[model samples]
Target: MNEQIVITFGNEKILTELKAAHPDRDLMMYQALSQPGEFMLLDHSGKDSVFKAPVFYDILSHSGEDKWDGFISFSTLDLNFDQQKVFDARINKLRTNGLPDGMHSIYSLNYHKDISQRIILGTWDDYADFELWKNSSDEFIPKEYRDSPNFYSHEAYYTPAKTKKTQ
Candidate 1:
């Protein structure tokens, strides 16, 4: 199945290097509003597209598969000491055990300025799937963290299509 992956860079220099190295793959870059020098490179083709780029292997701290033609959610949080440990442990469990039902993949990232801060980006096959996990009675995500102070939360639903370039 077609897959999507996001790889974040510490700064524009690294992103420029990646662009110079891999001209074949479609690499779309976005700057983070909250943190200067932070950038996110989105590759919707598949994991193989990312694996082929040597630069990705060098600087990527977090990378994961996303829904091919569904939706994506991104969030950033600043947690206390206890919350940080719990959050880390939960992320480790998810990574080791695999994603919860209806989820494609989730990535947990550390802020460049503050290591204690975290940013989570998740992709789901559909809106229903995303909601299922959020409102799950099983408590896939602990209640405390869910209600934590979220700095930002963004969601996008998209369908991939091919378009010819016009000169």
Candidate 2:
């Protein structure tokens, strides 16, 4: 399936390194309008295309993908250090135990700080699948992670209607 991914870097140094590492990859790089020095790299390509770049796994703290024209969702969680560890462990468990049903692709990013932001980007096979994953209870997620009062989560969903190509 054709895929769309968004990766954000906090500085030019990392961005430069990414460009140097993936000279042949097709990427749309732009500075964040609101956050100076922060760059966002967008790529739309075949399945698992982004995995070819070593820097994607190395420097990128935030990354997510959606199938072209399909359902995509993003969530940002703010958590403390202990909560972050629990969250990471839960994510690892989910990875090893298999993702919730209908999840096509999922990405977890932790922007470490006092109240770190843990962002999750996920795509589903269809709207129904997306709904299924969204409405699922704490059974799908770890209990401590779910019950944690020290964290806050915000989520948004998107469906692309058209694509604009710019030269």
Best by the lDDT measure:
1
Least well predicted 10-residue stretch by lDDT in candidate 2 = 54-63
TM-scores, one per candidate: 0.53, 0.54
Predicted candidate 1, C-alpha RMSD: 8.2
Checking candidate 1 for backbone clashes, the offending pairs are none
Candidate 2: where is the Cα deviation over 4 Å? 1-41, 44-69, 112-115, 139-150, 164-167
Q: Write the per-residue lDDT of candidate 2 for residues 45-96, one digit (tens) a residue.
A: 3224443332222112222343433555657777777766777776666666
Model 1 agreement with the true structure over 1-67: per-residue lDDT tens digits: 3423445454566665665567787765555434544555566445565433322221113335655
State the lDDT at 51 in candidate 2: 34
